[model samples]
Each structure stands twice: as structure tokens, then as C-alpha cells.
Target: MTLNLENEQNHELPSDCEETARQVIRQVLASENCPYEAEVNLTFVDNDEIHRLNREFRQIDRATDVLSFPMTDWESPANYSCLEDDETAAGSFNPETGELLLGDIVISVERANEQAKEYGHSLKREISFLIAHSMLHLLGYDHMVPEEAAVMEQKQEAILQALGITRDPEVRS
Candidate 1:
């Protein structure tokens, strides 16, 4: 698995924050048991750029925290059609290096920072949740229906909890 993180805009994100993000991503890749080599892009942007993307792609004309574009063969629930299965096992042969590109995830720092405040958590927790959520989306996991969403939510929570990142009240023992 390859992680390509690019910060084009002027944002002074801490090094620790970026490392933590990468660590979470690595764990996800390993846990997924993805056989073929994969490449993913992580981009950080501002509210304006993310809003434009939301309007253009989703046509919602609003801002969002994260956006994922998966380039693979995927056929699952109809409502989550926004995802394309990048499953290397599904005969999605990457012609070039026989490696699949698992699409991109763009995050709005502005939104994450704001949400952390609203959620009464650190920016680190918010970023971890966002990364985990988008990674699940990349793997074609969705909450389009109640059942599917519950499954995905449980996985998300499990991953976060394993990483010691949670939504629970602080456990001061």
C-alpha cells in the first residue's frame, strides 16, 4: 500500500497529526487484507475548494468534511452508487503496474476543526474519525440502509476504539 499525502494549500498542520493519519490508514489497509498493491491520495483543502467539489460532484451546494473517489469495480447497494469498487480481487486489473489506484480522499481542515469543537473532542480525534470513515467508503462500505449503516458504524467504532480514539467520556482511572 502506498499513501500519497499532498498539502497544496497554506495550512500549518502539525507533523504529529499527519503521522497519526497515516498510521490509521496503514492499519486500515492491513486489516482489509487487500491483496494487490494499492495507491491512495490524501489531500487537504480549505472550505471554499471543498464546497465547490460538493456542489460539482454531489450537487448539494454545501460544504462537507471529506470526499472520496474510488476507482475500482464495485456493485453493491444501489443508493451508495457513488463508490466504485477498487477491489483488485474483482478483476480490476491495473494495466500499468498491475497495481490498483484506490482513488482519493480530500478533507476540509476547516470543517474538521469546527466539528471537533462541536463534538467536544480534540482535532486529533476528529481527524482520525474522518480518515477512518473515508477509508471505509473507499473500500465500498456504506450506510445507505439501516442494516448496512449499522454494520459500517460498528466497524468504524471498532477501529477507532482499537486505536484508542473514541466518542466516550474520558476514562480517567
Candidate 2:
């Protein structure tokens, strides 16, 4: 998988933030059994930028911790069979790299830091959690309802746990 990451914000992020994001994305894809070599774009932004994005794209006036913009809509999460059959399949693959273009993820580092403090967790854990959650969305997972939310929560926790990142930094399983 190829991850194109850009840090547009000036926050003092963790030194290993980029690697952490790559690891979380890989874990999510592995857990979902994604079939293709994937490519994704990740951008870190400040709260103002995120707030603008949230309002423009989602019509939400408030800023969120993370935003996911998936390239394809799937019948089932991470099922790439439909893409293979699609007439636009040629457009889905990266021209030079030949990897399936997953989508773009925009994260608000300022918001994540605030949430980490509010939730009593390390910044690394909070950022990792956002990456995992956004990856699930890119794979077509949603939390519109309780059942879906539960599934997403479970999957997010599993992904983080696999990376030894948890809500409580003192504990790891």
C-alpha cells in the first residue's frame, strides 16, 4: 500500500506519527481482508481548516476530529469484486503505481489533541484511533445506527489493540 501523507498543520505531532498512520491503515485493511494493493492520501490540518471542510462537505458547522472521503462506494465493506466488474475500473487504479486508490483522509490534529486530553489517553492513541476509524469509513463502513456503530467501535478497538495502542496508555494487550 502507498500512503501519501502531508502535514499542513504546524502542530507538534508525535515523531512516529506517519509510521503509526501507515501501520493502522495496514491493520484495518488486513482485518477487512481487502484484496488489492491500495493507495490513500492523508492530510493533517488545523481546527479551522477542518471546520471549513466539515461545513463544506458534510454541511456540519462544527469541526470533527477526522474526515473520510472514500473514492468508491461498496456494496459490502472492503469487497472489491464490484470494482473489478465496474465499467470505471480503469479509473479506480492509480495510473503509474497500479494500486487501487482508496480515498483521502483529513485529520484535525488540534481536535485530536483536545480529545486525547478529554478522554485521558495519549496523543498517539487518539491519532491512531482516528486513523483506524477513518480507514473503516474508506472501506465503506458506517456508524449511522447503533448496530453499525458497535461494529465500527469493535473494529477500531481491535485495530488499535493490534498495534498496542489503547485508551489507557498504561495498559496494552
Assess the local accuracy of residue 40 in candidate 2 as a C-alpha lDDT between 0 and 100. Answer: 93
| Winning model by TM-score | 2
Error of 1 at 100 (Å): 2.7
Candidate 2 per-residue lDDT, tens place, 13-56, comes to 88888898999999998999888899999999999999999999
Q: Each prediction's Cα lDDT score?
A: 0.73, 0.90
lDDT of 1 at 40: 76
lDDT of 1 by residue, 97-163 (tens): 6665677899898888788778877777777888888887877778788998898777777778778
Question: Going through the candidates in order, what is the number of backbone clashes in each?
Answer: 4, 0
| TM-score per model over all chains | 0.80, 0.95
Q: What is the C-alpha RMSD, rounded to one decimal, of candidate 1?
A: 4.9
